[model samples]
Target: MKDIILRLNKLFESRIRLGIMSILVVNDWVDFKYLKETLDLTDGNLASHLHSLEKNNYIHVRKGFIGRKPNTSFSVTDVGRKEFKLHLNALERLIKNI
Candidate 1:
């Protein structure tokens, strides 16, 4: 339980990263537009946060032209899914124990 708690704490170390992770857990894939809309973040703000997550290998980017416009999509990787679930489970366990 202690080890799980430590790992979960690491997973949510940053505010923006934590929010991004929570969103990814629920949605298989999300668009840049959707993330900005849902989180009420500016373009630069969202892009930077997404980049951080990508750098950490927690999320993957799929960029392409949607018709004539550029579109960026994000999907959580397999490792990310496992870690996020573990974080969630740890939180639930800790709460239940309390």
Candidate 2:
């Protein structure tokens, strides 16, 4: 139990961050607006969590313009995929133990 707990990634402790990762892992690219709508979070709240994931290199951000409109999208990195899987496995083990 302790080992599984220890294996959990601290960066993914927040439900917001976990949700962001869960969405990113399955999708190729997700825009900021889509995430905000899906998570039902304010722009500031979502930006803060996105910044954390970006800082950790768990996600990749791309900024561009769709004609005159600005577009920002996010995708999961290789490290993120691996770490998230590990964290999920740890959680699964802990749950089974319980």
Candidate 3:
């Protein structure tokens, strides 16, 4: 229905963003390098998508040093988890209706 379609969050419309959420939903925390490798994204590309999610408060970031190198990790917020679930449910409903 129209209401169901409306429930699909535009923030997750991007395959990249959707993939990010999928990974984060399962893992406690994911590092930038691991995400980039898994998603096959360039540094700039992943950074851009991450920035968008961070701006929306759907994901949180932690930056620290591992010995001498800088390490950055990401995790989904509670809000993000709820919204992603709603979006997935909307997609399921759409598929069933179709």
Question: Could you give candidate 1's per-residue lDDT for residues 4-96 as a string of tens digits?
Answer: 567575746667777888898789889999888988899999898889778878898999888999999999998877877887788888888
In the range 6-31, model 2's lDDT, one tens digit per residue, is 99999999999999999999999999
Q: Give the runs in model 3 whose Cα sits over 4 Å from its true position.
A: none
TM-score of 2: 0.98
Better of 1 and 2 by TM-score: 2
Candidates ranked by TM-score, best first? 2, 3, 1
What's the distance in Å from true for residue 68, model 2? Answer: 0.9
Q: Please report the candidate that would top lDDT against the real structure.
A: 2
Itemize residue pairs with steric clashes in candidate 3. Answer: none
Task: Extract clashing residue pairs from model 1.
Answer: none
lDDT of 2 at 55: 96
Order of quality (lDDT):
2, 3, 1
lDDT of each structure? 0.83, 0.97, 0.96
* TM-score-superior candidate, 1 or 3: 3
